[model samples]
Structure formats: C-alpha cells, structure tokens
Target: MASIELKNVIKRYGKGKTANQVIHGVNAHIADGEFIVIVGPSGCGKSTLLRMVAGLEEITEGDICIGGRVVNQLEPAERDIAMVFQNYALYPHMSVFDNMAYGLKIAKVPVDDIKSRVDKAAKILELGPYLQRKPRELSGGQRQRVAMGRAIVRQPQVFLFDEPLSNLDAKLRAQTRLEIQKLHRELGITSLFVTHDQVEAMTLAQRMIVMNGGVMEQFGTPEEVYTRPATTFVASFIGSPPMNLLKDAPDAKPGVITGIRPEHLDITPSGWALQVEAVEMLGAERLVYGRWAHSATDQLVIIRTEEAHAVPVLGTTIHVTPRADRLHAFDAATGKRMMTA
Candidate 1:
C-alpha cells in the first residue's frame, strides 16, 4: 500500500480563453493505506477528479503523487493503481477465474502465479465457488465482485472505485459494502472511492472529501463533516434531512445564518413560535415540519422526535427551542462557518 497526494491539483478543458475549469486547486495528503471517499452530487466533478488521479484525464496544472512519485504525465497503465468502474465491464464468455486472471496473463505472469493471485482474490471476495461460472450466470452483486476481484488480482499500490455500488439494489449495495470493508481490512491497500451517495461516503470513508462545483468544500472524517461543517453548503448537504440553515430565525443576529440539526430542536413552552405544517411518521421516529409563525419568509424548520412522543397537531403553533450547545452560526455572505468567539 502507498500514500497518495494531490498538490494544488487543477483540471480544465479547452485552451486559452474558452478553458472551462472543473477541478479547482484540490490538495490533500492521503496517508498510507487510508480509505478516502470523494463525495458530491451528480455533475459535481467527483468522477473527473478520480479520473485525473487514475491518469485517465490530463490535469491542467499541479501534481499527483502516488508513493511519493509525481505521475501527472504517466499513462494509466504506469500509475500502479487498480480501478473498479460503475459498469461491470467483464468479458461475458470468460469465466470468473479467467476474468480475474486476464490482467496477469496479459503481463505474462507464470500460469501457476496467475492461478495463485486469482484464487487469493476470489477467496477474499467469496467468489471461490463461482470462479468457473460465466458473467451471465452470476447475480449482479456477484458480477460486481468479479470486477473488484479483477482489480484485486493486480495487487496495485492503490485502488480507485468509481461509484462501484451505484448499480446494486439497496440490499445488495449494503452487502457489497460490507464485503468491501472486509477486503480493505484484510489487504489494507490505499483506496480512493468516488460516489454521489452521502451514506456510502459516511460509512466507507476513513476521511472524506466533500465537493461542490468542482471545489473542495470540506475534507475530514465523517463525524467532523457532519458535526462541524466548514461551510454552509456542507452544513446543508452532509446530513440526512440536513442541518437547517435559517436566515430569518427569531431573535436572530442580523446577517448571521443560524444552523441547527433537526434532532437538536425540542418542543418547549416558550421559544421560537412555529406553526406545524406537516408531519411524517417514520418507522421509529416522527418528523415535524413547521413554519415560522406569522413570518413573511415562512421559513420551514424540521424537528425530530421519538416515536413515543406526541405528534404536534398540524396548523397549531408550537414553540421549539434549539439547544444552545448544538447551535451553529455561519456567515451569510460567504457561507463559511463562523468560529465561536
């Protein structure tokens, strides 16, 4: 396993005046064997950044280093990295064992060594029993495992995943995620996974880079990004139901944006008066959607409550207080986090 580093990485298309920059000055030092996830919405350049690191896209400027060697000009084959793409681009006629061993065979590895590597990868991915099966006979998750095993047999310094789980059903995705986690623990190869799903990022990442419009919005562990987001975009994007950003909060400081998570707001006898707008009964909890009482903006606020608690009546004014310790404040102009004084 080797560490990966991105030093002021930038990517653009076209030349001169018409050059449209997509990745803007991204920089990060990934520790040896660290699992990093690049996460963002669709069209946010996450895939573009990953492709640049894989040597698939030429970077406009800056350097990409794998194992301390700058590889900006290297071909993808020279980068010592393996990639598992969203599509399982397997040769349908070939069996799983042959698919996994194809790369080694191309490199002219000995017949016995090819079998050794394929066997090792297949065992780890639990594809041993189906090693002789063709792609058409296996399930989607099994096919994806074959794709991953193909990468694993290469035994490269780094592994790059481009939304490898996006094609699976919810249950299969969850199962594959566990398998990937186990694979990492067993092999401990440095990995950079790209996905648009935040839950996947939060679950699989040791550290995560949150991107927006090709810019790095935040880079930290899942807890850090979820609890202390560096920017308003992060504040609203990282959480389920997301942290509420209120510009016209009651008793709000002028020009300061107030941020609070739904669970951090509690029903109180007196505080911010909110009129209940809607209620959603989730399996184990209830979500109460309310609007600022008699306000011009009619800002919607969500409060999360336990299933045991009484559901507030729709249209009734309820007072909810944001916990003091949980309140987050940000700058309205720049959308950046405001350090607590």
Candidate 2:
C-alpha cells in the first residue's frame, strides 16, 4: 500500500491564447490503504484526474507523488498501480485462471508463483470454482470479479477503478459494492474509484472528491459533504432529491439563499403555505411535490414523509416548516455557503 499526493495539479489542451483548461488546480493527499472515490457528473474531469494519477494523462502543472516518490515522468506500468476499467476487459478465449495469470506470465514470473498468486486471488474473489470457465460463460458480476482478481494478483500499491460497476444491474451493483468493501477490508489496498453515481460514492468511499466542470467542488468524507456542504453546488449535487435553494426566502437577507432538504421540511399546521401539485409513493416514504402558496413564481418544493403519514389532496393547501438547525444559507451571488456568526 502507498500514499498518493497531487499538488496543484492542472490539465490543459492546446497552448498559449487558445489553451483550454480541463482540470483546475486540484490538490489532494490520499493516505495509505485509503479508499477514495472521485465522483462527479459526466464531463466534470473526474476520469481525467484519475487518468492523470494512473499516468494515462499528463499533468500540465504540479507534481504527482506515489509512496513519497515523484512520478510525473514515469509510465503507467512503472507507477506500480493496477486499473480495473468499466468494460471488464477480459479475454473471451482465455479461462479465468489464464486471464488472471496473464500479467504474471508476461512479466516472466515463475509458473509456480503465478499459480500460487492466481489461486490466492481466485480464493479471495470466490472464483476458484470458475477458474476453468471462459469469460463468455460467466455472469456479469463474475466477469467483474475476474477483472478485480486480475488486479489483485498484481499486488500493486494502488488500485484505480473507472466506474467498474456501471455495467451491472441494480442488484448486482449493490452486491458487488459490498464485495468490494469486503475485499478492501481484507487486503487493505489503497484504491481510487471514479463514478458519477452519488449513491455509490456515499456508500463505498471513506473520503470522496466531488468535482464539477473540472473544478474540485469539495473533498471530504460522505457525512461532511452531505451535512455541511462547502458550496451551493455541493449542497445540491450530493443529495437524493437534492437540497432546495429558495431564492428571496421570507425573512432572509437580500443576497442569501435558504437551502433545505426534503426530509428536513415537515408538514405543520402553520408555516409556509404550500399547494400540493403531485405525490409519489416510494415504498416506505412518500414524496410530496408542491409550490409555495400565494407566490407568483412557480418554483417547486418537495417534502418527504413516512408512508403512513397523511397527505393532503392534490391542489390542497398545506403548511410546511423547515427545521431551523437543518437550514443552510448560501450567498446568492457566489453560490457558496455563508458562515453563521
């Protein structure tokens, strides 16, 4: 295992006046054996940053250090990192054992060592019984495990995963996520995973880097990012229904935006009047969509309630109150959270 650091990293295309910068000055220190997820929407440069660390992309500025050694000029193979791609790039003709052992074989490792490593990895991944099975015969989750098994056999200092679970179905993705957490606990390998899914980031990451439009929005634990977002972007992007940013909220300062989550708003007998527009039943909870009563604008508000909670009829006026401590305040102009004195 190794620690990774990126100091003032930047990436750009072209040069001089025409240069288009993709990644801004991104700085992060990943501890040894830490599982970090680089999460953001598409085109946010999460993958680009991951590739830069993996040596697949060049850093325009700053230094990248792995295990305390600067590796800006080293090739990907020389970085002692293993990458598991989204496609689960396995050889269809090769058996699971052969696919897992191919890298060792190419590196001229002894046959006995290769066998031992492959066996251990297979046992760890529960692929021992399927060692002789071809890629085509395996299920999607099995194939993904094989991809992971291949990486485990290398015993690299760092593991890079580029949306490895995107191809799996919802159930398989959830199962694989648990499997990955178990694997990390057992091996304690330093891993960096990239994904656009916030749920995956929240579930799998010990610490996550939230990016937006090539900028590092926030880098913190999931709970910190969720509970005390640094900016309006982080506040809105990290939640399920997303935090609601109410412009020109009553009793607020002129330049402040009041933010509240759906679950933080409770239906009350007297508060801000809301007219229910729609309701969605989601198993154990209900989502009530509405707009503020007597307001000229049509900005929508959402409230979450338990399934047994009574809901007003559509078009009926109801009052909702935001939990005071749960409220977030952001500067309307800058979209950054405002500190309370």
Candidate 3:
C-alpha cells in the first residue's frame, strides 16, 4: 500500500488560442490503504483526473507522487499500478485463470509464483469454480470479478477502478458493490475508484471527492458530503431526487438559496403552503411534488413519505414545513453553503 498525492495538478489541451483546460489545479493527499472515490457528472473531469494519476494522461502542470516518489513522467506500465477499466478489458480467448495470470507472465514472474498468485486471487474473488471458463461464458458480475482478480494478482501499490460496475444490471451492481467492499476490507489496498454514480461513490468510498466544472468541489467522508455539503452543488448533486432547493422568497429567509432534503421535510399545519403538482407511488415510499403557494414560483420541491393513505390529489393545496435546524443556506451567486439556524 502507498499514499498517493496530487499537488496542484492540472491538465490542458492545445496551447495559446485553442487551449482547453480540463482539470484545474487539483490537490489531494490519499492515505495509504485508503479507499477514495472520485465522483461527478459527465464531462466533470473525474476520469481525466484518474487517467492523469494512472499516467495515461499527461500532467500539464504540478506533480503527482505515489509513495513519496514523483511519477509525473513515468509510463503507465512503469508506475506499478493496476487498473480495472469500465469495459472489463478481458481477453475473450483466455480462461479466468489465464486472464488473471497474464500480467504476472508478462512481468516474467516465476511459473510457480504465478500459479500461487492466480489461485489466491481466484479464491478470494470466488472465481475458482469458473477458472476454466472463457470471458464469453461468464456473467457480467463474474467477468467483472475476473477483471478485479487480474488487478489483485499484480498486488500493485495502487488500484484504479474506472466505473467497473457501470455495465452490470442493478442487482448485479449491488452484489458486486458488497463484494468490492468485502474485498477492500480483506486486502486493505490503496484504491482510487472513479464513478459517475453518486450511490456507488457514497456506498463504496471511505472518502469521496466531489467534482464539478473541472474543479474539486468537496473532499470528505461520505457522511460529511451527504449531511453537510460544503456547497449547494454538492448538496444537490449528492442526494437521490436531489436536495430540494427553493428561493427563500422575500417573505422567508435572506439567503440566496435555501435547501431542504426530501427526508428532512414534513407536512405541517402551521408552515409554508404548497400546491400539489404530481404524486408518484413508489412501493413503500411516495414522492410528493409541488411548488410554494405564494402566488407562483417556477421551482418545485419534493417530499418523501412512507404511507400511501390520504394521498393528496393534484393541484390541491397542502401545508408543508421543514425542520429549521435541518435547513441549509447557500450563497445565491456562488452556490456555496452557509451553516446557520
């Protein structure tokens, strides 16, 4: 395991008039044996930053260090890092055992050592039963395990996973997530995972970095990012159905933006009023969508409820109130969060 450090890293394309900067100066220090996930929407430079650390992309400025050694100019193969790509990148012709042993073979490791390493990885990944099968014969989750096993065999200082579970079905994705978590606990290897799925990031990462517009918005543990986001963007982007952002109209708060998570709000008798626009029945939970009832506002707020009884009809008035202590305020212009009562 090795600690990874990014010091004011930047990635740029072209020069002069046509210069396009993808990653602005990003600085982060990942502790040894830590699991960190880089998460953001498409085109937010999460993958670009990962590629730069993997030595697949050039660093236009600053430095990248692994285990206290500068590796800005090193080749991807020479960096001593293993990466599991989004597509699995397995050889179609090779059996699971062969696929896992390929990297060791290329490195000219002893034949006995190769067998032991591959066997151990296969055992850990629960792929021993399918070691003789080719990539085509494996399920998506199994194939993903093979890809991970390939990385495990290398025992590199760093493990890089670029949305490895995105291709799997929902159930498979959930199962694989648990497997990965268990694997991380057992190995305790330093891993950097990149994903667009916030749920994956939240569940898998010990510490997560939220990015937007090619900049690091917030870097913290999953709880901190979810509970007390540093910015409105982080709060809004990290939640399911997203944080309800409403303008604290002149009669309400004085902040540029007021936020209330769907779970933090409730239907109240003496509070704000809303006109129901839509209600979605989602098994155990229902999503109530409506807007504030002070004449008109274009934005809508969502409230989550577990009961289906007495569902509000559309266009009907409903009284809604949020816990004052649970409300979040943010700068209207910059979108940065403000902590207050």
lDDT by residue (1-341, candidate 3, tens digit) is 89999999998999987999999999999999999999999999999999999999999999999999999999999888999998998999999999999989988999999999999998889999999999999999999999999999998999999999999999999999999999999999999999999999999999999999899999999999998999888988998989987786434555568888998778877666788999998888889998876734567889988784579899988877788888878888789987645
Instruction: Assess every candidate by TM-score.
Output: 0.98, 0.98, 0.97
> lDDT, candidate 3, residue 108?
98
In angstroms, give how far residue 85 of model 3 lies from its true place: 0.4
By the lDDT metric, which is better: model 1 or model 3? 1
Clashing residue pairs for model 3 = none
Number of clashes recorded per candidate: 0, 0, 0
lDDT of 1 by residue, 1-341 (tens): 89999999999999899999999999999999999999999988999999999999999999999999999989999999999999999999999999999989999999999999999998899899999899999999999999999999999999999999999999999999999999999999999999999999999999999999999999999999999999999999898889989997767778789899999999999988899989999989999999885565778998999998888999999998899889898999999999632
- Please report, as a residue range, the 10-residue window in candidate 1 with the lowest summed lDDT: 291-300
- The all-Cα superposition gives candidate 1 an RMSD in Å to the true structure of 1.1
Q: What does candidate 2's lDDT look like per residue over 231-287, in tens digits?
A: 899998899999888886678888888899999999998998888999999999999
Q: Per-model C-alpha lDDT, please?
A: 0.93, 0.93, 0.91
**Which clashing pairs does model 1 show?**
none
Can you tell me which runs of candidate 3 are displaced by over 4 Å? Answer: 249-255
Count: clashes, candidate 2: 0
